[model samples]
Target: MTSLRRRLLILVAAVLLLAGLATGVVLHAAARADRANRPQSGGPAVSAGTVTLGRKGRLMFLNAATGPHRTAVASVPATDPRGGRTASGLTCARFYAAAGTGVCLQSNPGVLKQSTRALLLDSDLRTLRTFPLAGTPSRARVSPSGRFAAWTVFVSGESYSSAFFSTRTSILDTRTMRLTPSLETFSVVKDGKPYHASDINFWGVTFASDDDTFYATLNTGNRTYLARGSLSRRTVTTLAQNVECPSLSPDGTRVAFKKRVLSGAALWHEYVLDLSTLHETALAERHSVDDQAVWLDNRTVAYALPANGEVGSSDLWRVPADGTGTPRLLIAGASSPAPL
Candidate 1:
């Protein structure tokens, strides 16, 4: 070969070798970081008490006892909590609106790295304990009796190509902080494809005051509706339709949810449905709300509504659970408000 051509070939080979080495280094570093920072499982299982709720995106402190006007217990700034981003970063996203004493937070570190961890905090804003989870957590719930905890994890694989695989609901003995293996895992079914997606997600879970049967919503592609599932039986039965975010009454007789309708837009308004007759009623009718509803009690419900037409900016509102009283505003300009 000519001298110029030979030199050009040599330079190309050198560049390729360097590029491959750089790619390998990056992959190795990411894997190492995942292992180093992944959240550890096993918290001193304390007697389950009031559940806590962390608002999605922004940090919100709400006194689960005071109902919603007071200042938040503590707030986490919108930074990545994974340390790979920054020391002050918030790693949890799409946090389910927690509603007992506090909310359980789902932190997604990565799939293979360290699965999501459930961080439970108290009203004083203390770090209660980190509940290590397997797979990516899709939803979490603190039992009403404050004696148990349950969460759903979503697992994805190529075998379930058309659907996502969700592990059966993980029921935790709050006192032990360990998962009960007796309960069967629930999966989403669509067009004959089995999805590991948690049907009990984004406000999909509820527990009875007696800590017996828990209610959740499952999306089977054909329909998204409420299902009453026994904690022990691990069997689910469909109850109502067109409902999302079912918040069972403190008494476990009724449910409060966002009654969705096909508007030109993709938002659903908050509504309450009777579990007995499956009757539907609107709390804020003719109004569109994108936030989840928390039943303060059998008679009261609280949620956030966007004010000034601003997205990601909202005001907390409370209304009678019976759907009769005028909507009252509690906290203004707050993005998320969870009932204590």
Candidate 2:
């Protein structure tokens, strides 16, 4: 009977110790999150102002600096990218704008689970329409004419680095309010033969100047391909292998994309592909880029890379598209770059 009492006492002590450890972990996590929300020292000065996509000679991006304006839509003069920023009061997890239309993907906590949605914005950054999203926003784009918009979300795992994950990509015709809920329903032609697969996943859509044509990453059977899709026909055809997140050039002659360097690894090198020649030119940026690139112009491309020594922050960098010049920092504490 004495031995039984001793065992019970030991179990009680162990339970108390575990409770204390769990409390400590929760407190530490709360402290870290609090620090992230607070404004950091030497951060950029941001003030609320009107941000219009119609305003020419400007560049817009989601501000990543630690402060109240973090994740807000902010803009700087294209002539001076590092100049003072004017921020719109709106916030988003991912954003893209073209010709006067903007797509903002937002998320908020809910009673049961996290709720996500996409907001269609006008040139003045006002919400014109809202659509429910299935998961966390990954990439967003708008047609150059502002008639169409597309967004991708992670339906399963959070990051592309994960070996097993799924994504859902949607396209919207803002003019007619027509929406394609999932790209997977579209017919796929692989290597001049009709292909169908249960494991197919699509993401990182980039629209061409022509409203009917688009480019996106199509992954299936452990391989990724650059797919040229048609919105009118509801079909996509594989153009090249090992291409992810293809961004069509302004001139429409080449596509800037991230090419995976090692199989089953997240490492990637940015490359420009000539559509006519099917040739790829490796860009000068040596870092492993994980974000979909945006063309500053026909000659240059910009992308986001994780900030050095800063957690949960990213910076925008630009490199020449022809694989000539070195990579340069275009904007500090910024992501989702949109040139107006």
Candidate 3:
């Protein structure tokens, strides 16, 4: 064959190979998405039903099972977590509830950027109000009285493990509909003195029942500290270092948080801190937990861990607050455990 013809044939073959690979990739992606929307053979039974935040003796979570209900708010009897799940049509990236109020963070893709918002929900899961979010949602919490709500979002980088990132945390008063656009505007008292830094970032807010006080993770100077915040005073005081995502107990005596095990790394271990003595007790989970824990009761704390052999999913696990018992699986395909 002529040299020009030979080269032409080779180029044509290369284009065909590339076309075949592109087709395969598109097909595979479609198949994966279809599977995600269909119920799995052995997955837990889920059905559409009413989910109320005020329902007593129930446990609510974000369902992660492969089915139509995936990512929806689901509830089961706290006594029987493995029983059939009742799914609420509402979907959220992160969710938390207390009393009769709920805060749901939702994200949707946009042509120019990602659109994010926080929905204030009533007991019946109705959208009472919607607030625009600055970025992707990370953590959410409501005051035990259901009068206050808070949410955290990443303003720059997506992952907390990233070397550098910025977050915007906001608080809302449900009664008056007043909003605190950013917690950074509050005064910071680090180690009892006034503190200020250009790189300070705050996230993972957990509210106290009183509605005036809350706890959150404050990051500055390459270290993370547990900051006790007061909404009435508009101030935050650093309590301890190396603490992130602090969840207050029902009695408000202890905080369950994830402690970084190493510097400059994302690894963390679950721990409970006594507010009176400032003592820390590491839990028995052993695995790295990268979530803000929820106190199932005064004695037990639950958090989400990446599901075994599953991508983009997590399972709810609980451990004793005293740091004595082994970690037990509370829900197979769940995240964001909230007890009502």
Candidate 4:
């Protein structure tokens, strides 16, 4: 071969080899980042991973990652005198487990003239503190760090739901032990319109890791909306409508909420809304799910399926967050399910 041609070939070959090496490096870094950004199974490891649920008037631990899915390993009876079980015969309606802490909400009998309470507990079901709440309990959430807890409920004659319905949502800082009695007093900005309306009501709280930021549902002016709330500014801004019971995914990229699918009916279908794109994807669960959905992981959401549209009884079922797969019944006779 000629010397000139050989030299040119060598240079070209070296350039190709360098480009290949660079591509490999880029691929490796991308893979690592994808794994890092995925939702971790939160909290320390238990035996083969476990989940908690409220069933039969007690808190029970079940399998989270492995087989024997609905089996309960340990339990804390509602009547157990050890923890701060409230005097009103507290029955946990909504339960949240995260950041090594848990919160269980219980309420009085009816929508009006009602009282609710939040029971804060450790990983071992030992009561850390108790916060007595007002209104009829509906939804509850604790931040990923377990430093902030929030809840929402319906009150009589103050909400737009009915002549006898109103709402009260509250947040508590476990780190400082400071509580906001009601989020109703906070300023709200809806569609760029700032308002302080007597008829403004809120429900369904899902917290960000920062604990100061949260997402909730509000009912005002005969319409319901998804609202983003900031504790520092004490304000909530509306984002979308007909969305209720916003549950922030563990990865915090999307929110799983119930969207009313039926016209002139109280029935709702669950959906996931991507926060960045503001796009919503209807989940596979076409049945009316009246409760807030909980994240089993970033890819899966668990929520209770109301039996015959009844309130006090339901079965826990899980659906893919991607809106691709059918819901599989995870636990029977369980109302609320949360991964540990």
Off by over 4 Å in 4: 1-91, 108-115, 157-164, 308-311
Clashes of 4: 4
The TM-score of candidate 4 is: 0.70
Query: Candidate 1, overall lDDT?
Result: 0.53
Candidate 2: stretches off by over 4 Å? 1-33, 110-112
Candidate 2 lDDT, 32-106, residue by residue in tens: 667767987887777788889999999999999887788999999999998888899998999999999999999
- Score candidate 2 by lDDT: 0.93
Query: Can you write out model 1's per-residue Cα lDDT over 1-340, one digit (the tens) per residue?
Result: 6999999999999999988887887788787555534432331111222222333343342221111221223243223211111011222433333333344545444334655676655533345667666555545566655566666555553111124444444566655656663243643333344445424332257788766677776655435667676655556666767776677787777888876576333567778887788888787545665555666557877676665643334565678888787887654434333333
> Which candidate model has the greater TM-score, 2 or 4?
2
lDDT of each: 0.53, 0.93, 0.93, 0.70
Residue 158's lDDT within candidate 4 is 35
Per-residue lDDT of candidate 3, residues 237-287 (tens digit): 999999999999999999999999988888999999999999999999999
* Deviation from native of the Cα of residue 25 in model 3, angstroms: 11
- Local lDDT at 274 for model 2: 99
Who is ahead in TM-score, 3 or 4? 3
Question: Better model by lDDT, 1 or 4?
Answer: 4
TM-score of each: 0.59, 0.91, 0.91, 0.70
Error of 4 at 122 (Å): 2.5
The Cα error of candidate 3 at residue 124, in Å, is: 0.7
